[model samples]
Target: MDQYKYIVVEGNIGSGKTSLAKMISQEHDRELILEEFADNTFLPQFYNQPERYAFPLELSFLAARYHQLKKKLTALPLKTFVSDYLFDKSLLFAKVNLKEEEFGLYRTFFELLERDIPKPDLIIYLDKDIAKLQANIEKRGRPFEKDISNTYLENIQIGYEKILSDSGLNVLKINSGELDFVKNESHFKKVINRILTY
Candidate 1:
């Protein structure tokens, strides 16, 4: 378990990634690094008008992820770190949100910033069905997310899977539609045990 100095929990927008990461960090006493999604000024606007705000929103997220991860990972004495998101999530979202020409421009900057990111030792990907995901999203009751469609969520799901397949990192992909890691102790324990044994 010590071999996994850095671990990342990933999933679609409404997946239980943040909840799992929080629990793991609290129970296992690992350093937690959560993505500052609400801080992105363009996120609400992007949700309302993706075409107009997509580029800036993506760029903002890219810069934020790079800056936060670089600052926290390098300067902190975090032996075991659990983050809600992977750094390359910027690229994944950008690929989906940006147009071809815009993505080409974004990719150039992403590659340069990506070279500086320290890779995670293991990734726990929550693979949930779209129906469960939408339910979870609705339960959260974020206004910006209310407009999110199942098709959009599916696209993000596909994007996440594609990246995981190509990431070449030690990954544990779990079918998480039935697991309630946030409220169920047994389920959370199972997830924690899996990561530790990995």
Candidate 2:
């Protein structure tokens, strides 16, 4: 944790990546970068009508993520930081949500923007089963996320597995289904120990 200047906690929707990232940043006294998903106007529309909104939703997200990271990562007296998302998460979701031709075009834009962004020194991937993920999502009670199907979540999980496996980045995968770091002090300590030891 001390050696890495930039760390990312990544996982599917409702897998508690944000919560874990926040806790780590607060505890470690590092800067925190959380994804601004709620700011995306296309998100709700995309949920209801994916075919009509997926491209724009993804494009908006790409631009937002790039701009946010560029601004935050550049405005430095450079302290170590933890973010809840990896920049390539855009590509992962785009691959799952877009058509073949749309994805090709999206990938071009992504590649162009990605070269300029600094990659995380380490990525902490939280892996949870579909049932657990769904329960968490329901617990969170975000209306836009209420309709997310198990199949969709399963696809995202598969995408994460494939992407992380092929990515040359340093990654730590955690089985988070049984861990409640947000509430249980022991669980939180276990997670912190893993990161510190890794």
Give the number of the best model, judged by lDDT: 2
C-alpha RMSD between model 2 and the true structure: 0.7
lDDT of 2 by residue, 1-198 (tens): 789999999999999999999999999999999999998999999999999999999999999999989888888646888999999999999999999999999999999999989988999999999999999999999999999999999999999999998899999999999999999989999998998898
Worst 10 residues of 2 by lDDT: 71-80
Candidate 2 TM-score, C-alpha based: 0.98
The numbered model that scores best in TM-score is 2
Please give the lDDT score for candidate 2: 0.95
For model 1 the local lDDT of residue 163 reads 93
lDDT at 185 for candidate 1? Answer: 88
Clashes in each model (backbone N, CA, C under 3 Å)? 0, 0
For each candidate in the order shown, give its overall lDDT on alpha carbons: 0.90, 0.95
Model 1 per-residue lDDT tens digits across residues 74-167: 8885568999999988989999999999999999999999988899999999999999988998999999999898888888989999998998
